[model samples]
Target: MVPYIRAQNVNLTFRPKNRDPVTALQGLSLEVGRGEFLSLVGPSGCGKSTFLNVLLGLLRPDQGEIHLDGKKISGPGYERAMVFQEFGLLPWRTVLANVELGMELKGVPASIRRERASELINLVGLTGFEHHYPHELSGGMKQRVGLARALATDPEVLLMDEPFAALDAQTRDLMQAELLQIWDRTKKTVIFVTHSIEEAAYLSDRVVVVTSRPGRAKKLIDIKLPRPRDYEMRLTPEFNDIKATIWNSLKDELISRGIGDGR
Candidate 1:
């Protein structure tokens, strides 16, 4: 079967009138099977977020194209949703209202939207906090709100751009486990972008490593760990080995970018 999401010969460059253009992605090609959890990892300039935006139709590639469910992705659709690293919450809105924002935008009726919102709020572990506002919650709680809001639409593809980057280490781990559980129940296609090797390994079915500036797919590794994973799985030698492999590839990418001293 054709891959659920596919990108071929994609290239993107950002030009500032006064300075030379910087190429973010170059000839990058990838495929994510339906319901697959794929992670992208690399140094700072690899265009992981750019690729995510491209899939979201926020940015168009200069060359090649992106396809979802075997069709070209020309613009953003409710079928694809994004969770930003910043949480993107409206401080004035209560947790339930925030989660219902997408449904509200889609013209969903009040009664139905409220029901869905309540279900998602509970799914993300924010049941009692539905009446709470963003400022009233912790960072992790805020992120759970973001996650619920993203899933509120029941999108087929979930694009996450370092969604847990702002959380504390302990909370990040807990969120990862929670995310896997959510994925288990929903079985949506997930494309996650992150800077953490361990995070990628712990959460993805396959991890894509990209090169430095003008990034391209360097290598893709399959994660063979069992499902229903938890923090304890992170301590196993298998997990560390996967992390180390990605780290080695990432280290080379950083060194090539001249950001890391070989010392």
Candidate 2:
């Protein structure tokens, strides 16, 4: 089957003011299957986030191409939507109000936007909190609002960047379960960027490991675990085995960068 999203020989570089140039990505290529849950994991500055941004069309790569459903992606389209770690919600708006903002900007009618937002709000498990503002919600709640807003567009792909990183461990676990449930329901192709090997193993059908600095694909590990994954699965040997493989992939890159063990 043809890949749903394909990146070929991608390269991107930047020059900071009063500093030498830096390459963020080099000869990086990736292909994500339709309806697949894929995660990109790497150490800091591995271009994981940059890859997501390129796919989002917020940044243009200096070279190479990205395609979606066989069509070249020159710019951002409605087929893609993103959820960030910071929970980018308007403090002044209520939950439903924030969720409706995207469609509202697209000129969706009030009644229609309200209807769709209401459904998604419930889908993300924030029914009674529709009237609550961002400040009133907890960190996890705020991130849920962000996810609801991203999905409100009914986009074909959902791009998440360490969105659960800011939450407490318990909340992060809860959100991870919630994310899997939501993905099962929606089955939207997802490209997630995370630093945690455990998170990648628990959430993805496959994990893509990227090398350090001027990142390129180092390895791809197929998560053979069964679907409908939950917190308990982490305790099993199978899960840890996958985690070990990913850890080794990351460890090799880190060691090469002189970030050796024993601090």
Candidate 3:
């Protein structure tokens, strides 16, 4: 079967008047299988987010093409949902209302939207806080709200750009486990971008490493760890082995960028 998402010979160039053109991605190509959890890892400014924006149709590439489920993609659709690092919830809306925002935009019926929002709120462990506003919640809770909103649309592809980067370490781990559970239940195609080796290893079926700026694929590593994974999985030597492998790959790239001084 054709890959669910594919990018071929993609390059993006940004040119400001009188300045040399900045190349964000150079001949970057990748394919994500249907229902697979794929993680993209790279050093800062390696155009990981730019690649996502391209998938979202927020930016146009200078060359090549992107396709979803074997068809060329031209714009964003409700079939794709994004969860931003900064919990993009409206402070004024209650948790339930925030989760329903997407359905509301899509003109879903009021009763059906409310029912779906309630189910998602409970699914993300925010059941009792449905009436609470963003300002009333903790950082982790706010992120949960963001997750519920993203899942509410039942999107075929979930694009997460460091969605847990802002959380504390403990909370981040918990969220990762929660995310895996949700992914298993929904079997959605997920593209998670992160700088954390352990996070990528624990959460993804495949991890794609990219070079520094003017990003291109360096290697794509397959994660063989079994599912129903939890905190105990992190304690196993197998988990650390995967983490170390990714760290080593990342170290070389960082050194080439002059940011690997072991500071």
Candidate 4:
């Protein structure tokens, strides 16, 4: 059977004026099952975000192809929605308006959009804050808004580029747990790009590690931990074992690039 999402032998290169071409992805491939939460973890320049862009149809790969449910991804479509690291909210818009933005753009009826946005706002734990503006909220709250906006359209797949990276440690932890609850409830296929090994282990069904620049898939590690996970799970031997496996796969790329001594 065909996979829900498939990226085969993908490659991309960037050409800047008066500079040598840089390849971001080469021979990188992956398949994500429907409703699966997948994470990509690699060194800083390893094209994790680049791959996410490809999935979002933001950047066309120079070679190879990516498909969703057997359809080639040629450009942006409502079937996919992205949550950027930066909260890409309109500063002047209220949380409810921001969440409704995508559905509004898609020509969803005003009444329906407003109703859907309200439900999503509550889902993300921002029920009362729907009237609040971006500046009025904390980093975590803003991210919740972004997440709600991404989901308002009811996209089949969600692409997240280090969505929690900017939050403080405690908030990040809280958001991680919140995200799992949301995912369990929504069941949208997710492709998340994060540099944190622990974060990847905690959030994904399978974590894909890519090699350094001109990135390619290096290894895929499956998380065997049972779900309905809580913070206490992070302290379990199983979780740490998963972390160690991801670290082992990632450290080789870092050491090869001289970023670490592999200690």
Best by TM-score: 4
**Candidate 3: tens digits of C-alpha lDDT, residues 1-263:** 78788999899998989999889999999999999999999998899988988887888999999999878878878888888888989998999999999999999999999999999999999989999999999888998999899899889999998999999999998899899999999999999999888899999999999999899888999999988888899899999999888888888889989888642
Model 2 per-residue lDDT at 178? 94
**True lDDT of residue 224, candidate 1:** 95
Candidate 4: tens digits of C-alpha lDDT, residues 159-192? 9999999999999999999999999999999999
| Candidates 1 and 3 compared by TM-score, better number | 1
Per-model CA lDDT versus the true structure: 0.92, 0.92, 0.91, 0.93
lDDT of 2 at 54: 93
Off by over 4 Å in 2: 260-263
**Of 2 and 4, which scores higher on TM-score?**
4
TM agreement with the true structure for every prediction: 0.96, 0.97, 0.95, 0.97
* lDDT of candidate 2 over 152-244, digit per residue (tens): 988999999999999999999999999999999999999999988999999999999999998988899999999888789999999999999
Candidate 1's TM-score: 0.96
Total clashing pairs for each candidate: 0, 0, 0, 0
The C-alpha stretches of model 4 lying farther than 4 A from their native spots are: 261-263
